[model samples]
Target: MEQRWDGSVVLEAGRLLFRGRLGTTHAHAHAAVQVVVVRSGTVELADRYGGRLAVSAAVIPSRATHSLHAEDAQGTVAYYDSDSHVGRALRSRFPTAPGDRVTDWTAAAVQSACPPDAPGGGRAAAAPHPAVGRAIDRVRSRLHGPVTLEEVATALHLSPSRLGHLFAEELGLPFPAYVRWVRIRRAIELVRSGATLTQAACGAGFYDSSHLTRVVHEMFGMAPSQLLRDVQWEPGPQRIRPSGPGLAGAP
Candidate 1:
């Protein structure tokens, strides 16, 4: 019952696992690439650019913003570290494994840069909102220091407004909001994984623990301390816990 974002839940090797029900309209963009395997259920994924596709289980590349809406009321879902050794091994066996597999291998290449367990689930793995993948890479690489949205835009060769539009249209959040969400999410993972509050905050690009706390409370509606109190870790297969009422936004 590991419930923390940074936690892991282990399953019997080769055993099929089921993730719980997921939201119908939730979208998020992460720093790492993600491979989603739906053991038993129907899930619909929609990209930021109004592209919609149905996939039982699929590998989604990094920095591509997408949402998941479960077609079956009662179904099972599993997620793996897209950048993990297990993930790579699984991808190598893609289409050959089972279920529907959709992905751009060119995007998969970016995931090989680090070992699977490098931390923060190898950087969120949920793909970015289209071409903003490069911008996200810059954000991850420079998260430790102050990096402006303008700088990210420049690196991606787009105007700030265009970048902002991409984020809003694709990921369902504006650029600054998305950046804050990512930073806070990373900070939460770090803290739950054993970093001191201050350390986690700073490491995840927050000005201070208070800053992290504010964002966490705003997004998750719970204080970080309370959130980490019952945390546990599990490995093997992805499990989607029941969503709380306030747990809005992307899946």
Candidate 2:
């Protein structure tokens, strides 16, 4: 079933469940344990630690920071909330299993978990090529520092020219252009989260606010101040509170 931002479904045995094709980069964490069984096609799961795991189906824990890359030109996934009874049953059946086998029982289980009207669809995009994955990892890790094409190429043991070519071929963007996009995207997040333009720009590894403004305008067609004008600031949970012997009536 397709879940809305605040909606979730509890799956039962003999019910078939599925999710539509989705491609997104998460800016915040989500809280839902999911067990995904791929009836057909492949999926690549990437974590914050720069590790990429390719699996046809896998169990994902709630609040784990990760992104999904669909391998099937059109990938279909059968999934359910991991806390549900159906989820537990499927987990028991799989039992930490690892292979590419698509058993009849697994197929039946998938169909049973999904709604009758759900379509068995596939992902519309390809997984990141190996070179693209490496490049992306390097860029993401260095988003808070100066990142140059030569530096990334050196880290990946590829020539600058060759790396540029590979990026264009695999990701459809020049290496430098991709890096700029990453920087701008990161800056947008920081700015939206109550950081000053200068603070956000510097945090995102841009030379200064002016550089950030230029890139933001090019990518988003808006100035940082204008884009962030309506941003609402909310206080985060207090990590520590004043206490101890001198805490009371000291002033």
Candidate 3:
């Protein structure tokens, strides 16, 4: 943390990975859901209608736009892949709430739910439509290079529009957006395996390190350095394991 700001961080990751932080952030939205838990002090957030809501613990749904302000507060904010088991588990933490911020924080508690072993546990592909599955396979195969929607559509003998529609309908996001996520996922994995930022960026299709940083900040509301600076990770089965609460330096 910078001198002007007083903030501490704690990041623990696994195949069921997550990034937790205790700090403030400008307005931003990410592709993944975020679980914001204020252990001591309270934080304020603006809802959809621009109403200021105070909360200690809440589940911010994926892609939900919001900003936070926390100073000298003991809190834990965990970003979860909404498609993962832990993400679904956190979403179910709240009672019936139409909007963000679990209204009655005292009444409900949020827990990180997952198996002892993951990345292979409970992640059996809930396979998408056969065509979509095949499309995804193609994307994974061409991850090291460029694989546009048109090329994928042509390969599958389907019109671009039909393929785009199928991607949105079956995956709940556009083809390009999904591709970007895959690239970021690969980049993160490369970093976990001791690759430098620049190397990870180029290896994962990002133009450079700065390009990767901007995309990550736009998606996760924080620069990758702020998030990964203190994380000392060790390569695991299919993920990286942090040495402890907050490793002092990068791996």
Best by TM-score: 3
List candidate 2 segments past 4 Å from native.
1-127, 233-251
TM-score of each: 0.46, 0.43, 0.69
For residues 157-202, write the lDDT of model 2, one tens digit per residue: 9899988887754443457766775676566556545578899899
Taking the tens digit of each residue's C-alpha lDDT, what string does model 3 give over 149-199? 999999999999999998765544578876776777778778777788899
Residue 117, model 1, lDDT: 27
Q: How close is candidate 2 to the true structure, as a TM-score?
A: 0.43
Candidates sorted on lDDT, descending: 3, 1, 2
- Of the pair 2 and 3, which is ahead by TM-score? 3
Total clashing pairs for each candidate:
23, 13, 0
Question: How much is 108 displaced in model 1, in angstroms?
Answer: 30
TM-score of 3: 0.69
- In candidate 2 the C-alpha lDDT for residue 122 amounts to 15
Better of 1 and 3 by lDDT: 3
